[model samples]
Target: MTVYAVVNTKGGVGKTTIAVHLATMLARAGQALLIDGDPQGSAASWAAWRRDGEFSPSPTTTVLLGKAVFNEGKALSQGFDNVVVDAGGRDNGGLRSALLLAQRAVIPVGASNLDAAAMTDLLTVVELAKDYNPDLDVRVLLNRVDPRTKDTAEMLEWLAEQNLAVMDARVCERVAFRRAIGEGATVQEINKKDQAAVSEIEALFKEITQ
Candidate 1:
């Protein structure tokens, strides 16, 4: 199984959204298990909504566990093709365990000055994870990017100068994504013809799996 964790020390950075979509995308292709380690229980809440028939793909499987639940997650991913984990923010033990278990880690950054500044903290977490696994392949995914804004360009250039590995595709701020959670459907499931969303996810998947 390919284990990938969608992590960011900063909250409200679209971590859960990305996790949900990525898991569903892989699920459409094959089987996937989603582990929600956030104290907020956002993913777990979404799963409840789905099971209640308040969203699409009702009854989709999801595990909502606290920090230090890595052993359970590890066991769950054994026969799965993909295990997408939504690790909690801050120095949670689950986050550390997830990093240690993940073959690849993706840090999704929102296009904002504060979010950009938060990258430093995220990098610190990455360094911590490196101590446990030097071969960890960590990359950044620019999310909620405003293409027409100067911040996008400046941030990209700054990341480039810092020698950070960034995914080629950027997840733009879109209404479809904003509404996806309540509907229990990812952008692709809502509109398979959503070329932008599909391409963005596909690119990130390719970058990590490669």
Candidate 2:
């Protein structure tokens, strides 16, 4: 299974959004699993969104804490196309456990200096994760970006300078994203004909799976 942990030290950086969307994307493509590692259980809450009829095309998700991650590892070993873990900020034990199980670390950041600062700490955690798994593929995903601004270009350049791998896909700040999530719907299901949104998500999915 391809295990990816969505992480960030910064709050409100869209980490949970990325994790939830990516899980749906992977599930749409094929079989997958999603693990909620945050104590807040945002991911689990999202899964409940579907159970409560708040979402559509919901992906299978499990809320895991502490040693429950061990069972998650067994699931990954058995067979899964992908496993996406929604992780908490800082060096929380749950975060560390998720990192230990993940083959890749995905750090999501906003287009702001404060977001960038928080990402620095996340990078440190990525490096720490590497000590346990040398092949760990740590990458950055720019989220809530203003596609029309020069800040996007500047941010990408800045990330490169910091020696981080960044995906070509960028999620623009769109009302559709906010609306869909508020209604507990995946972008694909809510706006299947939304070409721009579809294109962005498809690009990110392709890059990660490839």
Candidate 3:
């Protein structure tokens, strides 16, 4: 099984959103597990909402909470097809533990100067993790991007110059994303009016998994 950790050192960068959506997408194929390493428990709450029938086409995924699960990553992987961990938004023990076990560390950065600057420390953590897991793939995902905005274009150019690997697919700022998540629904389960949002997420998933 493959393990992915959705992480960001800064809060409100959409880490939980990415984690839940990615796991839900993978679950379409087979069993997938979501580990909420964040003390906030946002991902766990999303799963609970799913269980309560807040959304249709409910995710066939299981979610586990706490940092202890990070120690058992290998054992958990043995039972699931894919394991996605939603690491907390900070430089903490939970994030570090998830990074050590993840095959891929997916970091989401918003299209803003503050978001770009915040990545420095997180990148350092990723570099540190390389000492133990040299093969770990570190990917930067551009999130909450507005393509029409000049800042977004500049951020894209800046990201290209960075040494880090950035995904070609970006997630545009959309009301559909907020609405879906607020209602505890995945983009795939949203209405036809939000088809573009669904497509954007699917593209990201394909690019990352491929």
Candidate 4:
């Protein structure tokens, strides 16, 4: 199975959002498993919201939560086509453990100076993890961006200068994301008013998986 981890050292960077949505997107193709490695349990909570019928049930997706998730996640991934781990937003054991098991790691960064500054520490951890997981594909994903703002352009330029690889696909600031998550809905499951948000997610999925 292909394992992907949505991780960042700083909180509120949209790691869980990316993990949950990416897992749901992958489930469209085949079976997908979401592992909640964060102690906050955001990903697990999202799954529970779905189970409680706040939104349509994601039948193709399975979610498992555990503190010692890396080894268990590897074993559990054998039954699924894809596994997405939502690691905590800290330079902790959980992030390291998730990196060990992931084939690809998506580090989400917002379009702000603080966010750009935080990337240094996160990238350092990723660089160290690469020694063990030599095949790990590390990529930076711009999140909560606003195309109309100059910050977005500056952030993209900053990322381009970094040594880390950055994905061409970016997630713009949109109410659809907040609305969907608040109501336990994926972008695809949301109403027609959020079609643009859905399209952005679909494009991101295609870019990542391709």
C-alpha RMSD of each candidate structure in angstroms = 2.5, 2.3, 2.0, 2.1
Per-candidate local distance difference test: 0.76, 0.76, 0.81, 0.81
Mind giving the per-residue lDDT tens digits that candidate 1 earns over 1-210?
A: 788888888888888888887777777667788888787888887777656654443324555454444778777787788888888784367778788888888888887778778778777778988998898888888998888888888888878876788888778887778676776676665644467776776776666667
Highest TM-score against the true fold, candidate: 4
> Against the hidden reference, what TM-scores do the models get?
0.88, 0.88, 0.91, 0.92
Q: TM-score for candidate 4, please give it.
A: 0.92
Residue by residue across 22-73, what tens digits does model 3's lDDT show? Answer: 9888887777888887777788788887777556434344444445656666
Model 4 regions more than 4 Å off: 54-67
- lDDT computed for candidate 1: 0.76
Give the per-residue lDDT digits (tens) of candidate 2, residues 34-129.
888777887787677656764544567887875456456556545667888888673366677777888887888888767766667667767887
Candidates 1 and 4 compared: the better one by lDDT is: 4
Clashes by residue pair, model 4 = none
| lDDT of candidate 4 over 65-156, digit per residue (tens) | 44356777777888888989888864377788889999999998899999989888788888899999999998989999878879977887
RMSD of 2: 2.3
Report how far residue 85 has shifted in candidate 4, in Å.
Answer: 0.4
